[model samples]
Target: MRFPKILLIPVLTLLITACQTGYHLTNQGYSRVQVDSLAASADSGMARFLQPYNQQLGQTMNEVLVESAVPLNKARPESALNNLLADAMLQYGQQKLGQPVDCSHLNYGGIRTNLPQGPIRIGNIYEVMPFDNQLTLLTLKGSMLREFFEYFIGNQAEENALIVGGVRVTIKNNLLTSIEFTNGKTFDPNQNYTVLVSDYIANRGGGTAFLKDAVRRQDFPVTIRDVFIDYFRQLGKSGKPINPTTDGRITIQ
Candidate 1:
């Protein structure tokens, strides 16, 4: 999908006080401090001293990359942030397994923060997806998938619905009246499909014990947070912003 136009904005810089100990300001007048070019030589002593640590830190965590055109958060049956997270995991897991991803299921509570519309920082990702949850691929039959949806529909009042992608559902009066894959094909009961899930739910089973019966459980090396961060970074290279909308995949009527 095409993202919104990319925009570059200046990073917010914080004012720092260089006092050795905590000091109370007696005067209210503004004071400026020199933060750069203190040394005349290109290879200054201070630069050399800090070079090793700075190089070690690298550009992985602090880089101001990726842009969000709209704020996304977990709302209810579906949310934009939840969609992106689920979609990101599904896409990444599929690539790792070299197979089609039929569905992705993650708990809404797993989503920690709203993705705001602005410069997406690696720090923001750390805040948003602050978990070491590993990704696991499972082979669940189509009937099990239906049973999974039923579990959610039966108890929609108490627990959060699974943040899902690659499938569409129509929940009417808490009953799943219609269901289909994103390709508009009905889930075949006899067919076994690749499912992506977080280690948390898969290990203990989800809202129901049906997930425990999934075949061919495979654990991946990377965390779910990295999958999301990597996807955001890839989108940054393509000039894509976080601009997902409600696709009506989970219609509540």
Candidate 2:
């Protein structure tokens, strides 16, 4: 009472200090590590369950596609899927290189798989062009074209060169006699023709030695994977189903 309200200040400060709570923090701790289940982590397990179903589904879809789509044998001269694939490569190559890509070709063996009869998928194309090869464009003159023809004939005279949109030929008695185009245009020997093709062929790995020429005038590096992707996407958009049919593109006679 002697110092009035000032006397109570010290007591209040002490009381506040005493009322504070303390946290008992610990330096050591325990952890419960979680491990993924066997089913989730094992790749073999996933493949074991999925492979059979994928094949069955592929087979059924292929059957359906074969029934509904246009047969290759009946398709117009350039309407075959193989031809279309080659054409797509040529177009892509031309756009990439800023030049006229004259023609495109693919080996029959390289077209390893066929389009299925039912629902076609990206996986189907992967099976068809499974290698990690790139698209290449070769500028060859008429003389080189003749050499290529000679080489191909020497290998398999009966089988015609599998070209896409720009060639007509007749094989006779194991000799390449007449080669023309749908437009009645003949291949000029002096004019340089830009051939859009696969890198494998350009490297002469696919049994055609003409591709081994020292002069690879220009090279456009493009992967076949991208080609197939674009092709599949277009097919899906158009709902234009395709079938595995043969044409005189590679004729026996």
Candidate 3:
């Protein structure tokens, strides 16, 4: 069947323009909004329609990563991805500092989103931590360190704030013990320990009341985002197998 070429051109153009226009509506002459009631209704609507999909998407991504990558012995799939990221930060810090940094900490809330499944991407990391928090090194006395551990245990359930990098610790009967590092090293109280943790951790935001009393603290010139990006790039360059599993970095005894 022969088609009318002239009529088809005009019809196609109108269809394209209509699709481009979309369905956006502008309210003419906006006045004061008594939106407290409307806000509540909108929140409830979102909870009903959007919350389930978001949770499902997170779970799906987690599963995809598991299926796509060779599982590592050190990964902790049950815990949040923030802990895994904190471990990477600590590893990078140890390489640069020329000494074993006691721990690396990142706030649970700071990890805004879950890691996507399948191939890991830099954009996913950005979505997880949208903030510009930088890495900070802090030195605290032995007593202050003990207090820091105490603070961690106190709010362990309430806030997922502190993730110990380069170290493994257990809380037993509300007491901290059985400390170890990724390289099977233990902490020395007398030695001046360098901690590679977030600036927020040094500021005591993660239930650490004693962080304010740190003896020596300095913020590194680089942002945490830069650290993660570099880590990912280096992994690609070295062809080192990337595993998203968690070792016994943070544990409950």
Which scores greater on TM-score, model 1 or model 2?
Answer: 1
Write model 2 residue lDDT over 1-253, tens digit each, in one string.
3656876899889889999997897798898777777435767888799999989877643432112264232122233666766766766665655766667766555665566555655666677778888877787877787667555555544343445646665666545566665445577778666666777778777566656663565555657766766655655665565554445554436
Per-residue lDDT over 106-197 for candidate 3, one digit per residue giving the tens place of the 0 to 100 score = 66557676654455566665666677888888887655665676665666466443456666677666667765656655566655566777
Question: Against the hidden true structure, what lDDT does model 2 obtain?
Answer: 0.62
TM-scores of all predicted structures: 0.72, 0.60, 0.62
> What is the lDDT of every predicted structure here?
0.76, 0.62, 0.64
RMSD per candidate (Å) reads 20.2, 17.3, 18.9
Better of 1 and 3 by TM-score: 1
lDDT of 1: 0.76
| Candidate 2, position 231, lDDT | 56
Worst 10 residues of 3 by lDDT: 64-73
Q: State candidate 1's TM-score.
A: 0.72
User: Per-residue lDDT of 87-131 in model 1, one digit per residue for the tens?
Assistant: 888888777657667888777767788877888888788888798
**Candidate 3 local accuracy as lDDT?**
0.64
Worst 10 residues of 1 by lDDT: 7-16
Superposed Cα deviation of residue 8, candidate 2 (Å)? 99
Best model number under TM-score: 1
Clashes of 2: 11
